[model samples]
Target: SAKHSDLCERRNIYADEKSSLESELDKNLVQRKNELEMTLIDARIMESETLVENESFDLELIDKRIASFRQLLEEKDAKIDELVKQQTDQKELLDKLRAAEDKQMDIINVEAKTSRKIAIKLETIEKKHNECLRKLSKMGTIPSDCDNNYHNMSLKDEYLELQKCKHKLSKMPSVNQKALDQLTEGREKGRILQLEKREIKAGYESIQRLIETLEHQKYEKIQVTYKSVSKFFVEIFQRLVPEGKAFIDMVYKDSADSGSAGSQASGSHASQESQSSGGISGAGLTPTFAQIDNFIGVRIRVAFTGKTVVKEMNQLSGGQKSIVALAFIFAIQRCDPPPFYLFDEVDQALDPFYRKALADLIKEMSRSSQFISTTFRPELLGSAQKFFGVKFAKRVMILENICVKLISDCNMN
Candidate 1:
């Protein structure tokens, strides 16, 4: 009971403290509201003073901003008008483009119709061509195949391809029909040219054979004549120069075992043609039978005492050359047996011994051939059967007979 009474007393005390704190909080709240009202009143007074001081400047700035905004709006209006004009022009151009495209489409439709007609005709022709191929296969004109897929080709694709080919062909140069028309004539001319070439080839072969035969005959003839003449030549030279030997040498360009005349000639006709052309640039200058050293030439080799040395005519002594020349003349005469010979001072450069030998040779050869000599040598003059001397006149020569015999021969030596 006592604890309860004390608790009531503390509660009354706490209640009294709470009432005092609540009253103090209310008073503080009222003071804060009054201070806020005073601050609002002071701010309103400052704001009114600021508006009064800067009102003219603010109004001028607002007017300037309005003017700038109006200028920008006018510029934007001009730009909008230019854009609208461009848009109208573009609309008109689009309409014209659409009309031109429509016209082009109509022309394309017409061309497509024509192409379709052509395609129909080509299809008919292709059918006929296939039928003809079938017939040809049956007739054994061509081999038949079961899988001829080419016949099933799309007409549209083929027509498109043909159009492309035609376009390409049109872009190229025109056909030269005139040159094509001359094809038959050209073929005929070509045939004639071929025939002519064959004929020329045949003729060349014939000529080559003929030349071989002639060369062989000439070689044989020279060989036989050289043999006969060498016999006489050695005998004559021995009589002139004791212990002397002489002979004629023959050289051949080709081998002795050349092919027979019956064989086909392996020699080229091109070489013959080149020879006929006679190029000076040495372009076709290959070695031939004629180009060999001393080919078909008769060279005389002679030695007065020992084995014969083959020397050129320029290398021999004058008298020795003269003897050789005379020997050759005599040899030739013996072979052909000429009816007469007219010699002009043939012993002019001969040595005394050779001169006598020449005179003796003339006397010996005189039996077979008549020797007419014009000489200044006493030995040859004494050997003459008939003598005629020339006495010079002003404009003429007088012929007088001289004694044919030497004085020592007529009497005693």
Candidate 2:
């Protein structure tokens, strides 16, 4: 009986322990499920927050870009407006220039016509003067104007003036005996005055003739000098540049005023003249002495290379311009050479060929004239007979004659 009781009690204890263990496991599973749910909800909230923050950042960046683009567009528009205003101003300036050009043309035409008329009158006066001189020469010994020196008178003019004076004095009251004597004295003085007037007129005419003669002589001298200088320029240019052709030409104020360019201007005088006249077809308004008449300015025409078109001195390179100037000096020296020419680094801008040519030319002409030149060119050194150098000692610069061998050494130092 005691053993049965102990067995029942043990069975009851095992049932309670199994039930309690099952309840504990069910509570743990429920708690674990609640924690998982809470964690998933927190993760979703964090994801949504991150998405909202990302969107806000993107919107701010886009707004900034749009503002920058708007500013850039405004700047471009302002630039465009400024350009348009400049263009308008340029157009207005061009129109004003055109109007001024037309006015200048009309004035030039009027002046040209006046010049022609004056020339015709001069010719007529010259003929009359010659005839009068021939008649007077055949008549007696030439009267000396020194006896009665008067200025600016004519015999015919004096007679007319005397008549007018007599008419004015005729209305005066009758004169007394003393007044008669005074009138007689006045008449004698008038006769002497007429003789003086004749002498003065003759003297004035002689002076006029002398002026005309001198003017002709001046024109001839100008022509001769131009020809000689032009010839020398051609020779020197040929020596310097065998293939290059260059020339000096007179640039007329009228041609520039007319705003005309020569038609078909090449390396010839005829072409240059046509260009100077602006190829005016109908009026033939070109002057015969247009090139030589006005001594306004001179221009240089050159082609540095054989194949290039001829250009003005203003169009040449710095080196080429220096070469041209050197050639001009050579021409002047050959024309009216001085005792000695002082040159300061004359070969600085010269090319090798030009330097050699210049040295050779100088050596050739050295016998006629002396050249005191300063140069670093070996060509000039080879041709030189004397050299000079400067020494700096104790802050003092001293000039001394240096030997040919020492020149290079001093330069190196």
Candidate 3:
């Protein structure tokens, strides 16, 4: 019995242990089922949120597409409206053009009818004129044998003037037919002579006035030119020679006025002399032309170095004279600048310093005018833009760059 009791106790203990283990396993299975259900719930919620977001984005995109389509429709509607307006304007213009065409047709028809009536009236007038001419011819009273009136008919003013003259002549004093005939020839001749004399006198007066006008213009031009050239002369001379200045002194025999008494007297004297001598070509007039028609003359005055007083041409040295001559040429050129200039050793007589000044002057002047200079000085050659030397052999020209050929070619020429 003790054995049996011990065995029962053990079995009971085992049964308790089995029941505890089964309870622990049931708790674990319940916890695991709850975790799985939570996981499935989370996944389902995420999928639903994702689907809602996607639908929202798709709806927004669809709304944007619809807005774009609506905008395109609006643009098309505006274009259609503009086209409709243009069509309406074109139709109105077409209607106006048709109305103008009808009005023009009416005016053309009226003008055509008026032209036909004028043509008929002209024909009737021509027939009456022919009949009048025939009757006048039969009576031997027609002033002109040829009775052509077509040209006169077109010239209403001339025809009216002829009619007035005829009326006046008819009202004049009567005279013996034979005496009137004799006086008519003399009167016509006298009238013609008188007209010729009047014409000659008028022509002479016109020519005299023209000559006076031309002389006045020439005087003014000379005064202006002299002033310009003189100013340039002084400037150029001073520039070429730092301590020198030059000027052109103008000497006039009279007041330099075309209407001056001295001028008139001189002109009259010249005319009388020319006539008396038969021709000015054969006259013993000086070939110098230093008189300038006895109107004016020019004298060059220059001063160099310590000489402050202006000296005449004979007073200057050779170098000073060359400088003065170059200055004069440049002065005249400035007044009427040419396209180009040709100078042959213009600085030959100039000192080294003056030669440099001449080169600078040429360079400055070349800004406005081109210069071609044959120069021996290195000072001028330095300022040259292009240097070319010429050689002549058998009349053939050979060009080289700044060499002895320069002098040789010039000697040949």
Candidate 4:
């Protein structure tokens, strides 16, 4: 009951204080409203002052955060400095490493060379050891009695025997290691050469046969042409010269060597040829064209009735030689007739009778061949189917007046 009274007394005291505080707060609120009327932003100024205080506190916090960030930046800068130093150290180390590698390579090369020399020396020693073992093996086991006998020999005698054996061994010839291989290679080369020789021989034989065949054909052509020319020459010469003997002789080196013997034979044959037709030394040329290369020439042998021996072309008169020339030309034409014959003043050296004979021959051949002759002789004019005359009216010689046959037909087409 006392504690309850104490609580009520305390509540009455708190109520009185609250009432006084409420009245005081109302009075303050009215004063603040009046102050706001007097200075419209006074409360805002007060709130701004508090806000400025809170902002100052926030600035302190930002300053602390800035200080922390600066420490962090300084730490990162130090780390960058440390990393740059490490990179510099690594670069220097890499240079040292490369230098060391080059030095090591030089050392390794030297060692490799030394090892190779040692290996070669070792191989030589091993070969010598193997050779000694092989020789000892070949010697086999010595008999006990022989061993005893060797043991009894003096040291000087054994040394002398060793020297003698060494001298004999030095005299032994060295074996050729490649003899079998060389022999095989030589045999193979020999076989290949033999095959090449056979092929060459076969090619040579084939070429030789081909040359022979060509030579035979060339000989046939020469003989056929010579036979026809010679036959016509005899008959034509008889017509041109009533009592003259003429023959075309192939002057081979062999016939020239026979001299007068060949001349006498050819002379007798020409005499008989006037009756019939045959010329001595009329055989075909040598089958080999190479022999034709050895040939001298064709000689014209003519014998007038007054002359006993056949005369060469050089012995005839100008007119007689001209006649023989005409005969020769006619003979060749009869044998292998050409499409045209061009005679430039051939009748100029001929006698009137010979010229007349030549004109007749031309007229006869005119049926098959065209003859263009330049001659002052009327005999050639008589045989002409067409004629062109030169007029010297101007300084230049102009061809004018086409005359077919006679001069009377100068305007003839």
Question: For this target, which candidate reaches the highest TM-score against the unseen true structure?
Answer: 4
Give residue 210's lDDT in candidate 2 (0 to 100).
Answer: 100
lDDT of each: 0.69, 0.74, 0.73, 0.77
Question: Which candidate do you rate higher for lDDT, 2 or 3?
Answer: 2
TM-score of each: 0.41, 0.49, 0.43, 0.51
Error of 3 at 135 (Å): 27
Residue 398 CA error for candidate 3 (Å)? 4.6
Candidate 1 lDDT by residue in tens digits, 1-413:
99999999999999999999889878997788889999999999999989977997899999999999999999999999999999999999999999999999999999999999999999999999999787544433222342364357688876686578568757765664345436767999999999999999999999999988887676567556756675566667766766665655443434223532311132233223322333111123333434343355544556676555434455689888888888777777678788999999989988777777778778877887798888776777655678777789998999988774543354333
Top of the candidates by lDDT: 4
What does the lDDT read for residue 133 in candidate 4? 84
| TM-score, model 3 to reference | 0.43
**Candidates sorted on TM-score, descending:** 4, 2, 3, 1
Q: After superposition, how far is residue 79 of candidate 3 from its true place, in Å?
A: 70
lDDT of 3 at 178: 46
Task: Write the residue-wise lDDT of candidate 2 on 1-413 in tens digits.
Answer: 99998998998999899888888868996788889999999999999999999999999999999999999999999999999999999999999999999999999999899999999999999999999887655433434772354235577865686577567657653634245446668999999999999999999999999987887777677766765666787678778877877666655667556553552243354433423443221122322443555666556676777687777777788889888898888886788888888889888988888888888988888898898888767778767788887789999999998897876665455
Alpha-carbon shift of residue 51 in model 3 (angstroms): 88
Q: Report the Cα RMSD per candidate.
A: 35.5, 35.3, 17.7, 22.4
Per-residue lDDT of candidate 3, residues 211-300 (tens digit): 878876776676577667767777788798777645454544544544445533444344334334321311213223333345466656
lDDT score, candidate 3 = 0.73
